[model samples]
Target: MAICKILFFLLALCIWCGKCDVFYKQVGDEVSMKCGVDSNSNIEWKFNGVLILTIDGKSGNRRKGLSHIVLKASASGDILKVPRLETRDSGNYFCRQSGKQHIVHVVSVFVKPGPVLLQSSDAELHCDITGDPNKEVQWLRPNGQTYNEKNQVIHLKSVTSNEAGQWTCLVKDDLKLSVTLTVVGLQTTAVNASKGDDIELPCSLPQSVFQRVVGGTWKAGHLPKVSFPTLTNTPSKILHWNGKDLSKVNFTTGQLSTNFDVTLKNVQSTDEGTFVCTVEFDGEVRLSVETTLRVVDKHSGKTKQHLGCTLFIRTLSFILYGLKLWIWIAVGASSVFLIGLIIVIGVVIQRNKRMKKRVRKLRSMRQPLTDKDYCQCINSSYNNCYSVIEVLQHLFF
Candidate 1:
């Protein structure tokens, strides 16, 4: 029975140790690894067959552990801690308990940064993964180059302009990483500013490469160099281009301004030209982008945009005026119709009352009062009371 028990324990050990788990950590982070179970007999940790830590309870064997490592015993389990983990810490760590045929735990550590590395130097992209036994990785660069290897990192060195694109990393369904590598350098995006308003001639560089930027310059057509800076530190330059006075250019005052973009203050009509931006960085010069500065008269009303806006306003005003006229005409016509209807109704009501009064008076008198006094209608110049037109002939007869 004891032999069978020993065999069973060995089988369990083989099974548990066969299962390897992946744990990801960057270089400077603290990591805690659990032994999964606490043994009363002995507990030991190893890195690639090298004995790292041992806790012996039976014979009281105590040994010095790795530097910067702390072993913690708790109700849950035994914990191995690293205060500040390094790149060398990346490997398989084995934890074992004494008299146990099965391994307690297997932890595989990896060191790398997060995705999307933007830098002036070479970029290193990482594929974060866990729970894969094969530990295989596939990499695809922006230049359509492919790599299939066990390594999880793709180191790109001496990157150039055309190399700026997407990089893909994959471990099938278990892991995947997509990263964009943007090599920051000279470039221009168009912007519009009024003649008198200030403008920024764009030249942008990443903050990580700030040391490489020696200086920047701006020029107008083939004329003499328009602007150059006196200072070594700041990105701004004093205007010297054209026959234009240097006093007109002002350094936009800021202690920590990033953009090398120049500002032309109180711009005039002569300032219109194809302005070019040339930047010198890291002992090399590159011409970046050109902006067309078209300065017009400062008059507010005559500009093309203002004219289009004014025409739109006039069209809208005419529509509103026509609508108002139609509405007023409809209202006046309705009022006239309403007044005429009211007058006709009042005349009918008065005629009905007079007819009723005449019937009652005739029944009471039983004699001819006067033809003119029996009925009254004032439709015309005639003032006779018996003025029913259909009965006028009978009354006369």
Candidate 2:
């Protein structure tokens, strides 16, 4: 009891200071909360400081707090319940006892779907509840299977007959609220395509939902542009609705003849927007299917610039590598030529020295034979010849 009083004091202090525990809930949900005190403890519940009920533990008597709103309290007065929550039910809740406050709860209520939901379109279901913020809650699908997440929004893509039903949001042993989803109207799709690529936007309805499509026109960004003749068993090309030629777009029917698919040829950046396909029924009732187109350009200016820089760097590297190789080759060739020239000069100088020595030796050998030796041999021969001539003359006389 003392701990409970302390906790309640802190909670009341937080509320008094304009900071309190908050609960997020959707309208039409059932709300249940605990007062954080003993079940038998005599407690009073207040909404926005107006006494809604005061339970007498001894007498088990119940009194109304506000004349307009009806709130339910458990027999022990420790639990508060609201059968059908509404937007007007959103406010601060207080649990009080003799001059002491034990808890403060702030409820915020909202509506997810306004009245009805469109068929063949995207929808969301939010499971917001009132209680401990950290507490977990689960959603029970229409098929009776439990969703794996807690306190999450369930996204319904291309809602169809299978999705139109009641869904339950369960807060473990605390609260359970059910909401029915009804789907009507045309189907919508979201398309993503790169610029200059082709994309198809589908517009179709199940035969069970819609009988026949009398006539329809296509609108881009809500401006009527393309139309086709009342579809027959055979699909045909779509022409400009206002006689202005639209060369880039075409239309065809699906195999079942229920599909009105629009093909955009070579999508451009200007084509990125919402496209609506309106189909008329027998009674002039028109339903529109929407397709949201997102055009992506891979060759952006920044990307081109980056690619250009990379190419330039590669080209420069190749050129420099070639120049470096040629420079080395030229240097090697010049060194070889200079070495050959020096070897030739050295050989020529050595040959010239040898020739000069040979000439000097020849000149020495050819020096005129010594004069004395040559004269002695010639005198001897001349004297002998004179003697022989004198003897021949004496014999003749």
Candidate 3:
């Protein structure tokens, strides 16, 4: 009986060692592998080629373990179980039966994080990672503040002058990775001024800050570096003087002034050039803005007066010429009408005289027949009679 029991145990061990199989499956999926001792015969299961599990009334040592997953094995030999598989669960696994051995599986799964935008007004930065395991993300500010939030995204609420600096993002996992986020500030206003006048160019800050005026310096036409002196009780209003002599330019208010305003008294035409404003802050000189000053003569007033006078003279000349043209036309028309009237009058007078002479000649041709008619006709000589008749006719007509 003892020998028979030992032989039965040896036969069972051989059957359990003979069945081994391995295969691959995706994460969050069911896993199953065939375990058989012989053809048309069920067998037990072994994990990693050593431990065994029984199936179909066969018994063996049951084993269960996990690398990065929950491993579960039934007393049944044909199946090995894994629950809630992850990226780290991807690896070699083994299954066993009677006398056959096979690699159970090698699994590979992928997972990726969403894209994120790290942006500023002057610069753009991005951070992304792709793998089976989620990556840890971090961001560092120029002020030495570290941010390690797990939202797959990070956004700056608003960019300010103080936020203008280098930023870094660190991704930690099986492999460590890093990216940079650069935040730059935007300039809202441009600097400008006129020559021979007091000018105050303001450098705008973010709206959050209460103070409107910030500290800044002046650079003149690519000249050498000159520090901006502090404002004091005496000559503090003038930031810089570019004229011939600094002593002549009055700055009783000292060098620096509040409100970033520069005053120039008695500014001259020669003090015209480009001026650059630079502000030192946040451990370095960040921004350099430029403006220009030009001295121009006040000729607009004179030009306007001259133009007004010229227009008045032109208008007067036009009126006079129009009047002269009208006078000449009137004189010409009167002369022509007068000459025609004189010729017509003379013709009419000559016609009347001729008619009178013809009438006298006709009268002279007539002969006297009776004594009374002869006496009436002999009252004057022929020429005298004709003249007297014409005179009478002229008076009567």
> lDDT at 112 for candidate 1?
26
lDDT (10s digit) by residue, model 2, range 156-233: 665676776788877545546677777666666687666787888878764433234456766785335534323432
Best prediction by TM-score: 1
Question: Tens digits of per-residue lDDT for model 3 on 328-395?
Answer: 66778999999999999999999999989887776676554465443234646565457556655655
> How should the candidates be ordered by TM-score, best one leading?
1, 2, 3
Which is the winner by lDDT between candidate 1 and candidate 3?
1
lDDT per residue as tens, model 1, 216-279: 5666763454453422444453322222345545554443234666676777666667777765
lDDT at position 366, candidate 3: 52
Off by over 4 Å in 3: 1-196, 206-216, 222-259, 302-397
What TM-score, over all chains together, does every model reach? Answer: 0.46, 0.32, 0.25
> Residue 295 of model 3: what lDDT?
45
**Candidate 2 TM-score, C-alpha based:** 0.32
Order the candidate numbers by lDDT, best to worst. Answer: 2, 1, 3
- Counting clashing residue pairs in each candidate, in order, gives 3, 3, 27
